[model samples]
Target: MKRSLQITLLVVVAALGLAAGLAWQAWRDQPATVPDATGTPGSDARSTITSLVVGKRRPDYQLPDLEGQARSAAAYDGKVVMVNFWATWCPPCVREMPALEELYETYRDRGLVVVGIALDNGEAVVDFVDPMGIEYPILIGEDDGIDISRDYGNRLGVLPYTVIIGRDGIIRHAHPGEIDLEQARAYVEPLL
Candidate 1:
């Protein structure tokens, strides 16, 4: 009976894992949409953004930093820009923060600008990053960040999405997952 129970538990874990994977994939492939501030269906945000590609010019947007100062793609002109969309509550996002900070520090002198867009409350973002010592500029987007991310070519609005833009204003790469220091270097050094 003990052996049978063990087998049953193992099967349940496997099934749960499979179900989670499937759910994640489905969400990732869902057609992009953004709701209004009133929580009603707004429209397909992808209409304005379209599907971005590696060679395409980075989309234009202006979001405020923690201090409510507006930041935009034009501000980073002639710089290697990495725009990362994340939230303070996401584990993967938090996990990669150190690596991103390190990447920003290592390449800032060489014209690398790592801009982190936090899709959450400004106070929460400030609280989280202050303890972590994240030096890169962080923009507060709340709900609109998702729409801006779609402009950057995130179809499903996934967290921890990163778009690396070259100094010429062309997007060089789009990384859509938690990144380590090694992966950051691999994607950034070539552009720098």
Candidate 2:
């Protein structure tokens, strides 16, 4: 009887340990809170990070250009504007910069304006732009930058969020990752 009781107690302990382990594993699988496209607290779950509609109306905020002049969304009105939020450390952001510059060069004459909002320090951006020869304007942003991003529908602070606004000042598309040139062209062509 004593041996049987000991075995039963061991089994109960083992069951509890197994249950705890499973619970921990389940918790580990859950997504952690990170910056949303807008730089606000958000989750990384793909289901929650899909395309978010930002709608019309430009967000009002002041950010300095490389030359220290104040720039705002109003600066690019009546043009097809592509506002891209990126950081220096993001590999995808680096990869997309050349394409973005090419796109800007190709379409700038045709009324396309591209703006990059650097969600990092101004000095880092300075370092990034000089070597890459980025022709489009890049604005240095802070926490409030997320607010502008949110206004354009980027709730998850994911690097490389692009908002394309039409000539009417209405937001036409919001992409959360690296944008393909063809796909971007398709979205902007209608507005042009």
Candidate 3:
């Protein structure tokens, strides 16, 4: 009788585990629900960082690209621009790079431009970007990135910070962390 009871308990546990695994698999296969530019249910859509910079004309800066080319924010005045501040050492920054590249390519011909401000050395930025096949204009910020980030409204000086400027040169969004592709699209699509 003891052996029979033990077998029954094992069978019950196995069944429960199988049921949980199946449920998890089903949930994993479900599509992710993308939130719109407005607030999603149970969450405020407005970001404090964006609130600080939005509606203000983006500050101009001239930073050097990888090949010693001077790229100025002022030069992109008539185009919608995304300026992303990132470091090669930051994991979240690395993870979201591909998404940024894709977003840039998708909207480049539609009046949207994406620029990456790498807070790392030019050599390191080149090494990191080359492996990832990053094709956007990358500015080497080095140590001056802290001050530049502050000018862009990133008071805390977070990595992977992003600022979106509309075609009229007004800041639209300032985000301080990694952003998914869908969320980025939502922010840029309406302007295009």
| Number of the top-ranking candidate, with TM-score as the measure | 3
Who is ahead in TM-score, 1 or 2? 2
- Tens digit per residue, CA lDDT, model 2, 8-117: 99999999999999999999999997543332224342224434554656566689988778998888889999999888888878888888888899899989999999
When summed lDDT is taken over every stretch of 10 residues in candidate 2, the lowest stretch is 38-47
TM-score of each: 0.73, 0.74, 0.75
Per-candidate Cα lDDT values, in order, are 0.83, 0.78, 0.83
- Judged by lDDT against the true structure, how good is candidate 1? 0.83
Candidate 1 has its poorest 10 consecutive residues by lDDT at 34-43
Clashes of each: 0, 8, 0
Q: Root-mean-square deviation of each candidate, in angstroms?
A: 13.8, 6.7, 11.1
Tens digit of per-residue lDDT, candidate 3, span 125-163: 988888788888899988887678778887666677888
Which residue pairs clash in candidate 3?
A: none
Q: How close is candidate 3 to the true structure, as a TM-score?
A: 0.75
Order candidates by TM-score, high to low.
3, 2, 1
